[model samples]
Target: MADVQTGTRRAAGPRDTVWREPAGIGQTRRARPEVVRVASKAIRKSAAIVLLLALWEVLPRLEVFDPVFVPPLSENLAAWYDLLLSGQLLEHFQASLTRSLAGFGLAIVLAIPLGLLIGWYTPVADLLMPLLELFRNTSAVALLPVFILVLGLGETSKITFVLYACSWPILLNTVSGVKTVEPLLIKSARSMGLGPIRLFQKVILPAAVPTIFTGVRLAGAYSILVLLFAEMVGAKAGLGYLIQDSQSSFRITDMYAGIITISVLGLLFNLLLLTVERRFSTWRT
Candidate 1:
């Protein structure tokens, strides 16, 4: 009887041990693979950039490239640091940021509604599409002289040029997004007794958000590109001006620093837009 009781107690102890094991241990084991996968993906994605930067640092030191014409990455970083300390970088960056935000904001305000109207109304599309096609083909940089002639070389011309350059992408994308919404979705909404305004608000707008964001991202890039040209042409202060002045004066390291700064700024801006895009596109997930 004692042996039987001891056997039963031993069996119970094993069962209790199994039951007492933490559920979190299993979850942690499962979660580790996912975390590792994400980390590996990130590393793979960053490999090319890392290689390029490594080459930039190495080739310059090896004298494979003339350091005068193409400075080492370290030299550029030093120059960038010096500029930062002197407050010059901040001043130029502020100037560029203000112009970019102004033109980008104005383009968003002007394009989205206009695009919706043109896309939704047949008559409006018929009247405006041809003109848009014509102007869209014309390069914004080519019209620099015309802008200077009219708006002059001040901030007005630069801002307006940015506006013109940024507007097309946003406008065209908005129009496309609105027009390309699924017909079935529209029909279903209508069948449910949804009014035109409610239909647009709920169905069409949400569906078009991804496409519209694509254009906004493009316009954000263009705002910087067009602004650079505008600044290089006449401006006394800006990243563009900094690069131009540095080059003209043969301060090669400084020029590269400015270029790096512009690249960093664009990268940061793109990341910001991507975050905003993701926020608006959570429904797709």
Candidate 2:
């Protein structure tokens, strides 16, 4: 018994000497300083953007660039304030918002169903791909005249321009999503005797959702770009018109404000989409 105990102790000795720290009770404790360091890094990164604005503000005043083309941040801010106070800025913004939203809504409605159809059906996708590719390649700006001819130079033309530009991305992404459904899942589904509708709902649609959303996001981006271009071509209101009108009138400061507005709108839309993506992608997390 003494020999056995010694042997057992000897066998355990190396393991005991082996350098393993004690296992954590549950989650490993994150160091406070490390956490602070991470947060500080994030702050620094965020502040870099502010630093850029500061440079933009300072550099022009120093005449590092032309004041006419590169106006000071202060001038731009003052311009924005003036416009905001006058309420003309809001009028332009509301008009742009109304047009963009209307066009985007229509594009979403069309793209979603068409995308699903093309994606879920290989033969349909094959048939439609060429035409879609053709149109996707076509410069949306080039169609401005055609839209004007058909719908007049009114809001109708502007809306049509946005819709035409936005539709392609959604349609293409949808096709990608649908066509990408896992074969194994489909096989398993078929074996289990799930009907076409049930298989699509339970498996295909869920799998394709991320792709569908990707398209929607792309469509949102495209709509903004197209709307800006269309408004530049023909419109008396909206942010695009604001930029053109301001620039043409040599109100460089107001032009900067309009550009800033467009940037803010795009950022908000992108943020909204990202939030939606995060909300829906629980399984991924």
Candidate 3:
């Protein structure tokens, strides 16, 4: 009777607890909230963009500004389509891209090595700092006439102008990056018998790359600005030339189209640099 009672008690206790969940089930539930939080943050950032686009589409219809001066987004889009169809946009885009890339490329090639040297050697830094200050303080616009006179109103002049404008920030940032590398890292590498070249290649370069990229991004922006200015000053075929011509002819729609194109190009350039930076600097992230 007692055995029978004990068996009954055991059977009724909890019925095996309905297969209780394994450990960490609560953690899995917690992770879901984290994911939702991240998604919400992304949505919040994008909200402003959506609002701006809506305002862009609605402002002209409300007639807050003259439809002629502030054409509806649809009219601007139509102007873009017309230019695309005529192939004028493509030609000018190619010209502007070529000049910008050439100048920006030259700046990168020249600035980085020179900057590394200046940052690596005290004497080099002392010698170049004064000269760097002198030229960097001078405006690129002020030198436009000099470049035009010396290099002539040609592709070379435009490329040179972009090079001059982009070099300063890139060089300066690279120097700062190199100088700011943690001394501990360098000492550790030296203790491991790493030579100067290997030390720089393995430790200094990697450490400084984030700062260097900051300058590169700045140079990219300067590249576009300088290219547009250079193209406007003298160019038979380019986006700047198209904008100038359209404005002079009172083709406001087409001018806006050109401005939009340049803005889009600048955005793409920055996005490209950002993507590159993220790919190379994953550890920092």
Candidate 4:
């Protein structure tokens, strides 16, 4: 009878046992699909750029385009590498970056507060709107000569040109952001006994952040574009100067390298702004 009971207990033990996967294994299995999804999305988004680069590489080699005027992408990349090795690339990049950042930063600092003031106060808007409209209608390119004449052909002129170009977008967008805050949000805040300053801090500013960021991104692009033009016209060291100089000297590969560098810089700057925008506006999500 004891042997029979022992045998029965042994048989039941297998059925009573429970099994679980190791925690790491289960987590890895769940994570793989997410990783794959992210990779696939990135690849899809980059497909067009890859196609364009392939065409750039092949077309010149195939003689479809004049190689003298438009060198193969590989040649341009080699030239870029040479420039990097010689430290010329870094020098030019620093010059351009300094001017761009100075102007861009100043514009942001000045425009946002002034924009807030104009947007919030009707009397101020009434006084400034006409002048803003007039200046806003004037092309930055047309005013380039004026800046050069007044500010002179130094760093001041270049940076001021960038500032002038970048400020309009940010200022306009800020004003619009503030004015377009939903009336319902304001009323809700008021009902909660929130004062004007608290209302602005808690409700208005948060609501306006998306619009404000849109302006900031636009200003960022303008900073690069306007600074490039300024550098091309007057600066001794910058990507624009490199491109202009290379083109004049018939160094097609170097010109293309400079052009590519500018494009990459613009892309990277925009990406940075986007990251910041996302951080600030996560409340929307």
**What value does the lDDT take at residue 46 in candidate 1?**
98
lDDT of 3 by residue, 47-148 (tens): 998887677779888998788888888888899999999999999999999999999999999999999999999999999899989999999999999999
Among these predictions, the greatest TM-score belongs to: 1
Q: What are the models' TM-scores?
A: 0.87, 0.86, 0.84, 0.86
lDDT of 1 at 255: 95
Query: lDDT tens string, model 4, 89-175?
Result: 999999999999999999999999989899888999999999999999999999999999998999999999999999999999999
RMSD of each: 11.5, 10.0, 12.6, 12.6
lDDT of 2 by residue, 25-106 (tens): 2124433555786687778878989998999999999999987799999899899999999998999999998888899999
Relative to the true structure, candidate 4 reaches a TM of 0.86
Task: Estimate the lDDT of model 4.
Answer: 0.89
Question: What's the distance in Å from true for residue 273, model 2?
Answer: 0.7
Off by over 4 Å in 3: 1-43
lDDT by candidate, in order shown: 0.88, 0.84, 0.88, 0.89
Model 1 spans > 4 angstroms off: 1-29
